[model samples]
Target: SCLTDTRMMIKLRAANEPLFTGRRNAAKAAWRAILKELGLQGKISTYQMAKKWDNLKRRYKDLKYPPVGMESVADGASSWPWFQLMNEAMEGRLASSAPLLTPVTQDDDHAPDRTPKHRPRPAPPPPPPSDYGPEPFGGGDAAEPSDGPLGDLERQWDALERDRAALDRDRAALDRDRAAVDRDRAALDRDRAALQAERLWLERERAALERDRALVEQDQVALGRDREVLLKMRSFPVSFSVSIYRPVSEREPFAGCRPGGKPEPARNKAEFFIFLNFILEAEY
Candidate 1:
């Protein structure tokens, strides 16, 4: 659509330029002839005619007349002729109804360029005013030393310090409790070691006692065998014999003589022998 509008504007510009030139020249020539007929040759010259033509052309070109209607242009160069014919037809129809148009004059040096101008940014809003009200220190009227509230804050701080001290004492107590537990655990370990050692000693003593008992049992068995042998030996007994010898002197025999007594036999070399045997028996 923009392309179409641009092409139409180009055609309109081309057609209008030539039309304006021709009409303006014709008007200038007619004015010159009228001046000549009035016998005022000094008033209008060829230069004056050209200047008037230029002014008329500018006036007509600035007129904002709408195009009669849409016209389709197949060829680019043919658009000018077609646009001229259409514009003449539209102008004839609105010759008496349309208002006269004036051109806008522009100064080449002072006129703003086609580019848009950048407006300066407005200054930031001023900062809000400070609120000066009654502060914790004192009112804004005068500086006054605080007596009650300051003392209350100091008391609160002191209370906090006391609480912190109490927490420290509790922590110390817990540390002592932990140390006592550790000591108890060490003592328990020592006691276990002693008990283990005692158990080992008891086991060794039990083994020694078993060995001694075994030896005693062996001794008892040997003593019983000896007793049995002795009993068998004493079951029987046997025994034996005796022998005697004597010598006497003759004088002794004479002294002991009596009338009816038998005289002792004269001492003489003599020998006698006797043998006896005995046996003893025992019950089973």
Candidate 2:
């Protein structure tokens, strides 16, 4: 059951954390997606999934940091069924005092005994009658070394050594996690810079478009003034001719026409102006 639970929790954490977009609605959407992916939308609600994860975290914290009066987990690894799995899942997210867990195999538990076997020896023969007055060291010889207080001291030393090793492993893991976080920060900074560049490019394009629009407006205004001038010119008769004849007595003289004897007819205003100019020249 613990294995199954841990596996489920791992999947949920993976799905939710990556899909979340920093919004409440997005988080709910991520939960829904996770439920759909796991085919548990109908059986389990998002609230339940959240509660289960919280419970798992709480349990992990309890094991990692036992109560004040209780002894710490000096064996390096916890005895909790799914602690190792949870540790892997929450590796960079949670702060844990526990060390890396190594599962014990059957071979490790059933290794061959290495303690030396006690061999029997023949009884020592009685010492020869001592002529010297009561040998001082006859039966007062000290007993062979027995593993009492010394053995306990050795066992404590071994436990302390294990605790130190576990602490070293924990420190190394923390260092690696820190490195990963720093990498993520650098990547985020690069992305921010890219987004800022894109924004500036959009602004420049918008400004260029504004300038083009202003030029187009000016052209439209010029065309409107030209249209008004052409409308005024259209008011004149489509066909007209002008011929002016003056005598030499006048200050201006007419050319190609002597006192208006005969003048060429003009078709349009342009030809009429030319005929007028010729008469003025003749008068001069």
Candidate 3:
């Protein structure tokens, strides 16, 4: 049961790897997610959880070593169908002796494969011994000299071929990268073109608005002149009249007036009934 739980926990960690991948707290996030799934949140720190994981992995590796009596199983025997079946059972069901350490040999699944450490270059074969030159001895058996100029030449050719292949790969990668850059540049150009078109449309619209505003101003000025002229025309009188009032006191006579357009002279102590009149004129 503990084994199953540990496997589940490991799987949980792997699942959450992408949750915070490439970020600063990726490990912390991964461990936290694992703990949450395992129902161990707040019960253990990520450091302690990682330590536990390392311990389990170490135990699993120990279990992967072949059992005490399996020495007779030659390395080539592993490829045999029965050996594969045995591996499967050990890795799958844990019913076999190897899987007694299921932490390592569960269902006979082979240990995780690792790349062999790079062996340093074989130090260029000592420059093919320049003092020996071409070996004239050995009855000129040219095909037999393993340490001769031919061997050196073959090595050099192999090295050149490797370099050429590496260069070809680099060139292909560069071409792919350049193509991606070109696609991005084209997209940028398209966006810029769209923006330019939008700007031009806006400018034309603004110009049209300006022209309309100018026309509205001119119409307003014309309307103002028409209103002023209409006011003057509406205000003209249809006819004209001039009124004159003559205030003549009875006690003092109307000394400046005569009844029938006659010139009158001044009088003393005279009383008379005064009259008033208004003159009217009509115009077409």
Which candidate leads the pack in lDDT?
2
Give lDDT tens digits, candidate 1, residues 1-284: 32332233233333333223232233233333433433334433323322333332332333323234412221222323233433343345423322222221121112113243787588898655322111111112112212233435434433543465467569779999999999999999999999999999999999999999999999998887666656744452322111112123222334455545444333121211121111122111
Where does candidate 2 stray beyond 4 Å? 1-147, 239-284
Clashing pairs in 2: 253-283, 253-284, 254-279, 254-282, 254-283, 255-279, 255-282
TM-score of decoy 3: 0.30
* Ten-residue region with minimum lDDT total, candidate 2: 102-111
Selected candidate, larger lDDT, 2 vs 3: 2
RMSD list, candidates in order: 46.4, 23.4, 24.9
When 1 and 3 are scored with lDDT, the better candidate is: 3
- Best by TM-score, which number? 2
Clashes of each: 1, 7, 7
Order of quality (TM-score): 2, 1, 3
lDDT of 3 by residue, 116-149 (tens): 4886567654445322122111122322322224
Tens-digit lDDT track for model 2 on 155-246?
44335434654775798899999999999999999999999999999999999999999999999988887776566545544433212233
Candidate 2, residue 102: the lDDT equals: 24
Show model 3 residue runs off by greater than 4 Å.
1-147, 230-284
Clashes of 2: 7
